[model samples]
Target chain A: MAERALEIRSESHTYPIYIAAGLRHQTADILKGLGKSTFSAVLIVTDETVGPLYAEEVAASFADEQPLYICTLAAGEQSKSMETYYELMTFALNCHLDRNSVIVALGGGVVGDAAGFAAATYMRGIDYVQMPTTLLAHDSSVGGKTGINHPLGKNLIGAFHPPAAVIYDTETLYTLPEKEWRSGLAEVIKHGWIQDPELLKVIKDQWLDLSAVPVDVLNDTIRQSIQVKAEIVQLDEREAGIRAFLNFGHTLGHAIEAEAGYGTLTHGEAVAIGMDFAMKLSGKVLGSSLDSEAYNEEMIRLGYDLTIPASCEPETLLAHMKRDKKAAEQKVRFVLLQEAGVPLVRPVEDDTILDLLKEEMTI
Target chain B: MAERALEIRSESHTYPIYIAAGLRHQTADILKGLGKSTFSAVLIVTDETVGPLYAEEVAASFADEQPLYICTLAAGEQSKSMETYYELMTFALNCHLDRNSVIVALGGGVVGDAAGFAAATYMRGIDYVQMPTTLLAHDSSVGGKTGINHPLGKNLIGAFHPPAAVIYDTETLYTLPEKEWRSGLAEVIKHGWIQDPELLKVIKDQWLDLSAVPVDVLNDTIRQSIQVKAEIVQLDEREAGIRAFLNFGHTLGHAIEAEAGYGTLTHGEAVAIGMDFAMKLSGKVLGSSLDSEAYNEEMIRLGYDLTIPASCEPETLLAHMKRDKKAAEQKVRFVLLQEAGVPLVRPVEDDTILDLLKEEMTI
Candidate 1:
C-alpha cells in the first residue's frame, strides 16, 4: 500500500487529502495527526450499500473516543435529495450532535454530497471529513462543493463548505463493479482533458481497462485528479472564475444527467458523452483542429455510450442547459474543449446549441 | 429624510447597512449607486402579514431593474420551520432564479432568518439584501445568522452568510404595534447591558415609553443598537469568540423561547425575561452587584411581561439550555453579564443552572 498526501487551501482554511490503501484502519491516528481529534460526536453518513460493507469498520476506528452515530441513506444519485437532506438534519439533532461534532461522509459521491450538504447546513455549518469509499468520490471529496439536488435542477441547493480533511481509502474500490469503475473514470479523464493533459496519458498508457488499474497507479491517479480540482478550488474557492473550467463537460453533462432523470446514467457516463459532444462542437464552432472522431473512438474504447437516449430530447436538454444555475440572462454557456487539451467557457447561440442537439438525436 | 450608513465586513465581503426613511422606494438607484446593479432576478421573501403591508412597496422599489418574484411565508417564529424553508427553495427554483439572482429578505426576524437561510443555501448561496419590516429584525438583519428552526431547536439549520447589504427602511416601523416596539427594545437594551451602558441611557431617559418614541430618537437608537451587534460581528464574523458575547441573554433566552414553543412569546419578550434572569444569576453566582431589581423595574416599566407564565417548567429549560448548539461535551457555557456592562463566557455547572431555574419557577 502506497501512501500519498495532497494539501488543499480554501479561503477559510487549508486541509489535507490523504490517499492510501488501508487508511480506514488508521483513521483514528490520521485524524489526530491532523489535529482534528475533538469531535463531540461522530455521524457516519453512508449509503445502504456501503453501510453494510465498510461503515462498521470505520465506526470502530473511533473506538469510543466520542459517541458515534450512523445515518444510512438509500444508495445512488437519488439519495442526493431534499427529503434525505432534511431527514439527515433531524437525525443529527436527535443524535445530540452539536457544533463540535464532525460528520464522516463514508461512502461514494452521493453520500459525500448528501452528507456534506448536511454538514454544510446543520447548525449553520459544521466540520466534516470525507472518507470516500468509491472512485467517483475522488472528484467530490475535494473542492468543498457540497450540495443536494433540487427537484427542478441538480445542485440547485448546496454550499461551498470545505471538508476538514479527506481520508481516501482505496481498498474499498476493489468491491466496486466494472460499471462503477467506468463511471468514476470520466471525471478522472475530465481532470486530464481540462487541467493537465499529462493525467490523460497515465490513463491512456497504463489503465485503459478501468478495473485493472494497479494500486500505485490508482493512488497516483486519485492524487492527480484531486490535485487538479484542489488547485482550481484553491484559486477560486467559490467558483468565481477559474473553477468553472472544472465544469468542462458539466455544461452539457449536467443537463443530460438531469434530463435523463437522475440515476438513469452514472454521472461519468453522461459526462463521457458530454465530453465527446464538446470536442465535436469545439471543432465545428471554434474551428479547433481537434479530432472529434478520434476522441469518440477513445471514449468508445473506454466503454462509454456516446449516443443520446431517445427519451432525453435535445430540446429538453437545451432547456435544462439554459436553466443551469450558472446561466444569467438565460444565456447558454459551455466549457468547450476546443483543442483537445484546451477548454474555454463562452456563450453559444441557442440556435447553435439546438442544431447540435438535433443532430445528436438523429444519431 | 435623514439617511445613515454603517459598513459590515464578513469573511467573504463587506456590505453596507442603510438606515433611512423611504429607502425602499429608492432601492433601484441605491443598488446602482452601491455598484450592485445587476440582478438577474429578485426574489422578495416576506411573511403573510408584512407582504400585504410592505412587500408590494419594496417590490416596486426594484422598478424594472430585474425580474421580480415574491415568496410569502406564514408570519412569526412558526414560519421558520424546515418545511417552509424547503418550500422556499422549490419556489426559488420554479421562479428560475440562478446564482446571479439576489433574495430580498423583507419583514421581521422570522422572514430574515428563513429567507436569509434560503439565500445562504440557494445554489450554494446568493446575494441577499435585508429589508427589515419589524424592530425585532434590527438585531437579526445585521449579523447574517440565517436559518430555519429544527423541530428540536431554534436556528439549528442555518448558515453564517452575510447579506450583500442591509436596506433598513424606517418608514415601515411606523405601522408597527406597541408590542412590537417593546419586543424590539429588549435587544436594544441588551446591547446596552452587555456592551455599552450608554445605549441604556438613551432608552432610559427619553424612550422609556414604548409607543411614543420620536423619529430622530428612534433612528439614533436603531443605529446604536445595530452598532453594538455590528461591532461584535465585525470582530468575530463566525461567532468564534467575541460574537458569543452578543448571545448574552440568549443562552437561557433561547432555551426559554424554544421550551415555551416558538411564537408563544415575542423573541424580545422572552429575551427580556432571560436578561432579567441572567442579571439575577450574575448576582447570585458571580456575586456582582448589577442591581437585578432595578433591571426588573426598568423592564416592567418598558411594558414587558417578566413573569415566567408558571407553565414553562424550569427543568425543561435546563434541559434545553444543556442542548444549546455551542455546548461541547455537554458542558453548558453562557455569556454572563456579571458586572452589568462587562460580560464573560464560562461554563456553569448543571446544578447551579437547575438551582437558578428552580428559584425562578418559585417566583
Candidate 2:
C-alpha cells in the first residue's frame, strides 16, 4: 500500500505524519532525511509490553554512529506519572545523552506523553520522534501536547513539545488486543462526531466490527481523523480558542477516567461514554438536533459500553470535572455538539451536569 | 525611588518587569493590573531563608478570593535539582492548584529556576510571576530560562519559560549576605563585558564597594544590566542565535561550579573566575586586545576571587565544559569577547582549553 503523508502546521513547528503498513523498519532513513546526523545519541522510550516486541527492530534501523539506549516503563496509564518522568530523565542523563540527543517514543499514548515530556524538559528541550504502535496515538502524535498525570488529575503536568516526526506503522495494529482496538476506535469516532460528519457516515455505513475493518478503509479513516485534529491544533497551538472544540467529550471523559482510577477503563472507553452524555446534554440544553437513538445503535453495534459504572457517583464525577484544566472561574465547561459536526464549548451549571449524570447513570 | 517598569518583548509573549524598593508589598495591585482576576489560586514557591522572612507579607497582598499556598525548598543552589522540582509538583497537586493558578517564585535564581520550571510544565504550562529577592535573580528572572540542576551537571535540564511579570523589590537586596552581593555582581560585570562597556566602567569607578554603593546607583546599574539582557532575549527567546552570548562565562563558570560542588562556590563567583580565564584566552587565541590587567583589578576590587581552586582538577573541568548544553559534536564552545561589546561563540579545541586550564591553575 502507498504511504499516506499528512502535515501538521503549528506556530512553533511543522512536522509530517506518515501512515503506512511497515514504516517502523524505515525509521533510520526517515530520521536521516530529517537531519539525523546532528544527533549523537538516540533514547527509545517504550513500555514493557511494546518494548520486547518492537524496540530492537526500531533500534536496529538507526546507524551505528549514534548509539541507542532504551528505557521501558510499565505498560499502562500509571506509568504516566511524575515518578516515571523523573526516572526517564535520570536514565537519559546516565546514558550521557546531550542536547543533540534524540528521544524516540515508540509505543502508545502513555509512552508518548511520558517520553515526550522528558524530551521537552531534558536539557531544556530536545528533539523527539514518534513511532506510534497503537491506533490511539495517531491523534496524540499530531498535536504537540505532551504531559504526565498528577495524582489529583490526568495530564496535570506537561509541555507543548511537538515531535520531530510521526511514523505510524499500521502493521502493528494486527497484534493489538481486541480491547485496545475498541479503546482506540472511540477516538476515531470522536473525530468524526466533532468535525467530520461525512467521515462519521462512512464509519457507520462501512465499519461496524473495528477489528475486521479493511486496511484501506482503516488507513483512510485514521488519516481523516488526524487531519481534523491537525487542522484544529494548527489554528490554535495553545488551545486558546477553537482548539477547545476538540475536547467535545473530554470534560466528562477525563472525570470518569480519573474517578475510575485510570486503567480501570481505557481513555477511549471513558470518552465513548462521555460522548453519549454530551449528546444527551446537547439535546436538552443546546436543543441540538442530533439523532440520539441512531447514534446509540451505531455505538452498540461497534461494541462500546455506553453505560456509566455503578461505582462512579454522580457528585464525585461532577467534582472531578470541575478540576479539569478546561474549567474556568469555578465553573464546569463542556464541549457540546450543536449537531453532529457542529461543536460548541460552553459553561454548564453544576446542577445541570448533576441532573444529566443522574439520568445517564440509570441508562 | 519611583517604580521603574520595563517591557520584555519576545515572540511568544510580552511581559513587564517591575523594579523598585518594596514592590513586593504591592504584589496584589501589580498582579491585578496585569489581569490577575482570571486566576483561581496562587502558589508561592520560595526558599527556607526567604520564606520565613517575607512569605507572609507577599501572601497577604493577594485578595482572599484567590486562595494562596506556599512551598519552600532549602535556600541554595542545591535546591535547584530534579528532586526539589518533583517535591514542588507534589505540593502544587496537594494544594489542588489547577490550570488557572499562578505560581509566584519568591527567592533567588534557585527558586526562580525550579519554580519557573514547575509552572512551565504544570498543566502543560501556566503563568508564573518572578518575585526575585536576591540580586542574582535580577539576571535570571528576565530571561525566561528555567530548569533544575542534574547530578551530572549544573542546569543540565531546563526550559525557556518567561515569567508573567518580574517583581524585583530592591529593598530585599538590603538584607542580602555580602557573598551573594559579590556573587551577583559577576553577572552585572558580565553584562558590561558583553554589551555595555560604559556600564562596566561605571561599576569599576563608582561601585568598587558593592555593599557601600548608593541605592540610586545600584538601582541604575541593575536596570542597565536588565536592559542588556532584555534586548538580547527579545531578539532570541530560545537561545538559537545571538542569545548564546548571554553565556559569556557560563561554559567554564558552570564547570567550575559543578566541580566545586553546588553550594561551595556561588554561581557569580565561578563566573567571575570564568570571565578572567575567558579574557586571557581571548587575548591569546582571538588576538583580541582585552585589558586583562584592568579587568582583573576591577574583579579584585569588587571582591571576586579570580582564581581556580586547587582541588578542582583541570581535566575534570575541561570534561564538564565539553558536556555543556552549548557544546556541539564533542566540541567545547565558548562565548569569546573579540573586544568589549563584541561577543562571538566559537568552537574551541579541547587541547586549547586543556592548556588554558593548566596555565590558569598556576596563575
- DockQ values of all predictions: 0.78, 0.72
Worst 10 residues of 2 chain B by lDDT: B322-331
The sequence of per-residue lDDT tens digits that candidate 1 reaches over residues A145-179 is 89998767678899889999899989889999988
For residue B267, model 1's alpha carbon misses the true position, in angstroms, by 2.5
Model 1 - which docking category?
medium
Clashing pairs in 1: A124-B158
Deviating ranges (above 4 Å) for candidate 2 = A1-4, A35-37, A258-261, A313-316, A322-331, A349-363, B1-4, B35-37, B323-331, B349-360
Give one digit per residue, the lDDT tens place, for model 1 in B173-254. 9889988888899999999998889988888898856777777788788988999998898888877798888887787777
Candidate 1's TM-score reads 0.93
Instruction: Flag regions of model 1 displaced more than 4 Å.
Output: A1-4, A258-264, A308-320, A323-331, A338-340, A350-363, B1-4, B255-264, B312-320, B323-332, B349-363
> How good is chain A of candidate 2, measured by TM-score?
0.94
Cα lDDT tens digits, model 2, B253-289, are 9888878976788889999999888887888789999
Question: Candidate 2, DockQ to 2 decimals?
Answer: 0.72
Candidate No. with top lDDT: 2
The candidate 1 chain A region of ten consecutive residues with least summed lDDT is A322-331
